[model samples]
Target chain A: MTLAAASHGFLSPTGVEIAFVLVGIATLGAALQTVTSRQLVHAALWLVVALGGVAVEYLLLTAEFIAWVQVLIYVGSVVVLLLFGLMLTKAPIGPSPDADSGNRWAALTVAGASAAALVWVVVDAFRATWIDLDGTVQGSAEVSGRSLFRFWVLPFEALSVLLLAALVGAIVLSRRGGDAKGAAETSAPAAGEERH
Target chain B: MHLAYPAVLAVLLFCTGLYGVLARRNAILVLMSVELMLNAVNLNLVAFDVWLRDALHGGQALTLFTIAVAAAEIGIGLAIVLLVYRNRGSSDIDRLRDLAERPAGPAGAAGSREAQPDTGAEATA
Candidate 1:
């Protein structure tokens, strides 16, 4: 029975669409849990799930290159960095009582309104539009590479520079305390000599 | 797949992130919320790219740029959050209220003066 639906042609909605909806629901559920989870570590882990779902969504959209990049950057690196931050900062591994503020109701209200507005506008705009997935594969690395290096070369280079700067900035900010401590230690003797 | 499917999904994800940002007290969680929002934007970009059927695949290319920028932003943001946690012994954003102006008391004025020379020495070092 399910195989019949899976074999449906391009004209009819098929298993791919079913999988997309399922992944979308899972991703949305994970995202909500990520935000609402009281445990900091758990929240980070849930974020991993949510990001992985997004990567799968990209693959379903047929952008294979972007999907891999999303997996590598978001699921692989960013979530690890977040966990490191949480551990380095000595955040409680268990439920954090202070994780939430008193403005939950207000925030939910705003979020709901904005989401409704965005969904309405998008559906109204693209209600009749249908993508022809049977055409040339646009999600391949070859096509993506050409587009990236050709018209978007400038922004791509700028992004690399930005990443480098952020790397340096993070090191500087995190090490500033150590630098300050070392300076204090070395300057203490100099101040004593000046006093004498 | 209908364009509205991914579009609506993105909107829902973006809104959840927004709620996280506004309601979360921990700075690290707030950063995670920001990441969620960025992912939502990437979904929209990719969906539009496929829908438009452009020769250059501009939406996907731009999505790549967005991913790179998001990585950088998260790196710097986490570093700042760690620094604050180290100095203050907590990462609660509500407790980080020192940015506001306050009336200068005699003790506060003298304290600033005493710290100035130390800062100058460190600057030169």
Candidate 2:
């Protein structure tokens, strides 16, 4: 059986419609909270719901590997790390005065335009294409892993290096400005001349 | 009607995420919103993957890469946000305006501006 049937076997179209609506509602609720929740941590929690809904939708569509990976990487690691950073930085964790301000209008304008553009592109491109639900195999982890290390190897390695550079940059930036021994030692000659 | 499901979900997810990215000041919350947007894209990819399972598994492979890149993004993004918060005592994107337009300024306002592209849809949220 295809992953689609595995997800919901023998369901009436109405049943699928009901499930879709329910999931949509849940997804929207979490998304709203992600934006509107005053607490930073609460926003992250809401993101979990939104991400989880996507995973479920993937499963329903027979893309099991993508679904599980979404759970693992996005829900498990990414959000947890975000929360970790939030705590480490000592963010207000509550209502912040700067959270919403005069820029709301500007932000809304930009966001709306981008969304409209994206939706337009997607809809326009696919307007004539019909969804073929023929039970063909797709989304196997083995196949995807091979492609990653094969044809896409260069971009993959580039991403790794980029991440490494970002890690080092973060460490350098986090150090106190005046305390770097390298900078202090280099400036010692100038200090001596000034004293003379 | 069936095709509309994925399209509608994509639009909603994208809009909600856009709102979060714009309205939420906390760096972590902004990251979560980005994840929402990525998830929206993933849905599109998988839908296409299923629809066109012949020749080249394009969508599934792209989703895999997207996941990897997202991981790296979170790692780097969190570290930078932490550093900024430590130095400035806040993660509010608005406050980061201090870095605006400074030549050779710390990975500055462009980052905030890049994260703020959803101004119009954000109001409906």
Model 1 over residues A25-64: C-alpha lDDT tens digits? Answer: 9999999999999999999999999999999999888999
Model 1, residue A159: what's the lDDT?
Answer: 85
**Candidate 2 backbone clash number:** 12
Model 1, range B42-107, lDDT digits (tens) per residue? 999999899788887889998999999999899999988876675556788987765444466568
Q: Among these predicted structures, which one has the highest DockQ?
A: 1
Deviation in Å, model 1, residue B23 alpha carbon: 0.6
Candidate 2 Cα lDDT to native: 0.71
| RMSD of candidates 1 onward, in order | 6.6, 9.7
User: Where does candidate 1 stray beyond 4 Å?
Assistant: A1-12, A176-196, B101-125
| Highest TM-score against the true fold, candidate | 1
Model 1 global lDDT (CA atoms, 0 to 1): 0.85
Task: State the C-alpha lDDT per candidate.
Answer: 0.85, 0.71
| Candidate 2 lDDT over residue span B1-125, tens digit each | 15556776788788878877777667777788888888888888888777766456678878877888888788878877875665456677776664355465456676556545443222111
